[model samples]
Target: MPFFLRTMMKVLRVPKRTIFIVVIAFVLGSASIAYAIEPTTFHTWFNALYWVMTTMATVGYGDYFAKTVRGKIFTLFIYVFGIGLLSLVIGKIIDLLSTVYKHWEAGKLNFHGKDHIILINWSKKAQYAIEEILSFSPSSHIVVIDESDKHPVTDRQEIHFISGDPSSEEILEKAMLKQAKAVIIFADTRIDEPALADGKTLLIASSIERLHPAIHTTVEITQEKNTKNFRHVHVNDFVLSYDAVSRLAVRAALQQGSSEIINQLIRREVGDDIYEIPVRPEWKTYKDAFQGALEYGATLLSDRGDLGINRKLNDPIPEDARLFVVSDEQTYRRLLAI
Candidate 1:
């Protein structure tokens, strides 16, 4: 090796002894050899590097050639060794990408971002929840935790998957539960018994509470009677999945089109869905806020989960108030701007 080539390799940090480093050293050394032997044919340093690149890439443009016997021998050596080393590097890169993609699809990677919604368990209800969340906030990041071998939803970029036992703290940490906006746990319907499914959900919810007590967690249970069991855990909310369906069915039969109305309210894509809005600076009382929303074509529903805002119209609005309203997306946008 030339003194300058050795010095250049040292400056380039080629002493790491990695395959990539070795490949870089080989290419640079080959370029220097080509330039030193045939300075007339390869007039510039860039031409020597370009010739090495074309030969290693198998492009063989044939613009540069070896005129001497020694140059031809060196060219034959490159054809045998240089091309093989470049091919090895290319194959390694392809393999690395394939492994990363496989790990991602298999839910083996960790989510490093914050404020993402963490979903526990995969089911039809979870699928609908993801759809509804996306309808409301299309840019929302969702991290799904399930015990499946592969990701349930692969087509969407906003949704990520982590495969493991939901009750495992390691798995929750992998999903970045500490920085999550909220967590939704669905009953694993694959289990034969409803009690077993609820038990799984409860265990996962308890784990979440232990890991992050302040993280708002909503759980779905198959049986309404089992709600008492979760009283110990500080779960934010619970949904009786089967009981809700049965109640909705009875309501639909009793008060025609009631289920449709409820469905429309729950779904963001449907007309007049529920939305939360911040209090405007000019609003002083419930009446002021209510009338302001009415002017913007929105109906005031409640303030901070208090549904009796209609009766409390004369009362002053609380300082830490969160108002809920019913309006279309366009009307909500207009209300937000005001």
Candidate 2:
């Protein structure tokens, strides 16, 4: 064994896998330059590089070739050593890629983006949430973090995955919690009991709040009873999964088209979706707010934040009012601009 190769093997402890890559790169590069020196149809360095790539991919176009005896001899040399070595290098590189993909799907990789939403659990609901986010805010980045050994999203793009307990500071920091826009913690539906699932969800919410109380956290509680416990944390929104669904089902049973109406109100994929925008300064009362909403072609539904939703049209709008309008994303943005 060469001294450097032996030393590298001892130091890196990966055998010839790493050494072959470096050695093949150096050898192939040097050989191509030496063979392309004179009139061998390769006039420029770029042409020489093109020949090497085409030859490696087994796509010899014959646009460049060996004309002289010396160059022909070098071509023979290339077939024997160059092609074989290139094949080995390619195989090893592909193996490395497959290994990386496996790790990524297994939730072994850590997230590295900023201002992204972090999802704490993986379920069918998580998949739906991902699809909805992609539909509504296509530009937003999402990182799905789960403690389970299985990865939820491997084939998906524009979304990242991290496998670790969300409550741990190491994992939270890995997900870039300090730079996160929001953390959506989902209940463990596999737990079979709402309280048990909500308990675990609350624990994660508390851990996140403790790390950065300023972080906007939306938690899914399995049971309505768990809402009181979430008050301990600075959770910005709560999804009463079971309770809300059940109530919706009841309403749907009582009123015709109630389920479809409710679905349309919050649906993101098609039709008008619910949007929240700041009530501009000119909108001092509900009447003005309605007029402002009409100008933007959005129906004013409710007010959020330091304001009540079910108010008369003549009622005064609160200073810290956020209006929820029923319209497309463009209309909502237009209303905000007003």
Leading candidate by TM-score: 1
TM-score of each predicted structure versus truth? 0.89, 0.79
141 Cα displacement, candidate 1 (Å): 1.9
Candidate 1 local lDDT, 193-312, one digit each (tens): 998989888999999999999999999988888898887797888998878889899999999999998999987887789889999988999999999999999999999779999998
Off by over 4 Å in 1: 1-18
Error of 1 at 294 (Å): 0.6
Taking the tens digit of each residue's C-alpha lDDT, what string does model 2 give over 184-256? 9888867897778888888899899999999999999877876888987778999888788889999999997
The global Cα lDDT (0 to 1) of model 1 is 0.90
How high is the lDDT of residue 66 in model 1? 84
Find the number of clashing residue pairs for candidate 2. Answer: 0
For candidate 1, the per-residue lDDT at 249 reads 94
Give the Å shift of residue 317 in candidate 2: 4.4
Clash count per candidate = 0, 0
